[model samples]
Target: MNTNTNTNAIAAARQAHSTRCRQRVLTALEQAAHSGDEITVSAIARRARVDRSFLYRHRDLHAAVLVKAAEPATASTGGPSASRPSLIADLANAHDRITRLSHENTQLRQRLSEHLGEQAWRESGLCPPDDIDRLQRRVTELEQHTAEQRRQLAERDDELDATRATNRELMTRLNRPHPDGA
Candidate 1:
């Protein structure tokens, strides 16, 4: 009976219309999925006459809707078979994609294993390979350093021996040659 209540009802109807517009956009997306053809979001927004960002922000919901929509329709013949070639084609395509991605995943895992092996080598600081090499470069360097130190030690021992021998010769000469002076 009041014009004020009529205005509020009109506003409520407009809001409901906007909500339905957004829902219709989602419906269009669900219908287009599994064809392997690109579904342009802009086209959806244009068809719904709604803002595109709202659809983008709720993309997970959109994806869920598409998945639900793509579910196999009930087989009137009580089994899934040659009766539904279109559905079968879509399922076959999905199967192929799953297999291909699985193969790629294995290859990636192998490469990651190789990368980890290289990292372990770098971290351990072990002599780089060639345990049976002709010249064993790292071991050769260690052996050369050891030989140099041994040579120096032998020379020092020789000098000590020569000092002892001279001391003994001087003592013999002193004891024997003093008879002439007496």
Candidate 2:
């Protein structure tokens, strides 16, 4: 009998929690609608301070958010106008595109980190792609500077060789017999 009573009490508490979460989600939707904010699952979840998974799991709240999201926007002073539907559609399309792009970005980042290898990143303390790109640019700049220095050094060596040859020729001429038999 005690076990039965405890089970009943636990069930009641879970039900109450579910009810409260649903109410919060609904209230968040209403507030978003009134404020002309974009009606999205994430926005509602954030406003309600509820987990998004909860919103997705609650069928009623999920349907409500979707319906609200599909509604046309209206001016604060005016009711819904004829042109508002198209504007709302456009907004929904943009939101969907943003969501898709965000997912893609996440996937790309994951792939990049995987390709770069976890051990390499840990050992080098470099973030994927960005750090690699920076290092590549630095290496290229250093290579160019090194090539320039090498060319300058070669030029200086050539000049020194020519000067030394000229000096030796002058010394030889001075040591040689003059045309006047000096």
Candidate 3:
């Protein structure tokens, strides 16, 4: 029996690929419950491309995605109307637009810590202010322009040491032997 007909043709090709992955995860949970959408086991394993651990090992597609994620959202012109906005007035207008954008981000971070002064607001550790009087008047105008460039480089090194002591006394009076011994 050719190995019992090749083990019943590899168990009928793994039961026709587990009946085409359980009919594409029950037609992607009936097209995410006819489009109100959010059903979930990772949105029916990304609309049945499959494996969220095969929709958590299929306990009836994980109890039909927890009974279509506890059902309640009907409205497509089917009933509830008094001019729409209910889910607790859309969660109290999203908590009053997140408390008016968290008090306009604390008044634009207290006007950028009073326009970034105090040594650029303590080197940006945010807010602390003794106001570095304009960085101590730009470090007292760069220490009086570095003490007037060190008094003009000590008067050009005392005029290059008096022109190198008058060129070493005119090369010691032309090498001394000009005493009429021309």
Highest-scoring model, TM-score: 2
Superposed model 3: Cα runs more than 4 Å off: 1-96, 103-135, 169-171, 179-182
To one decimal, what is the Cα RMSD in angstroms of model 2 from the true structure?
20.7
Global lDDT of each candidate: 0.70, 0.87, 0.80
lDDT tens digits by residue: candidate 1, 50-121:
777766767764565445445544434566533234666889999999999999999999999999998888
What is the per-residue lDDT of model 3 for residues 1-182, given as tens digits with 9 covering 90 to 100? 99999999999998898789889989888777766666768878888887888777768878888886666545466875332235558888999999999999999998888876666757888764456688888899999999999999999999989988998999988889987899
Candidate structures ordered by lDDT, highest first: 2, 3, 1
Give residue 32's error in model 2 in angstroms.
Answer: 0.8
Candidate 1 to truth, TM: 0.27
Tens digit per residue, CA lDDT, model 2, 61-125: 89999998877644486775434467768899999999999999999999998977976876796
lDDT of the structure predicted as candidate 3: 0.80
Per-model TM values vs. the true structure: 0.27, 0.44, 0.30
Model 2 off-target regions past 4 Å?
79-182
Error of 2 at 171 (Å): 78
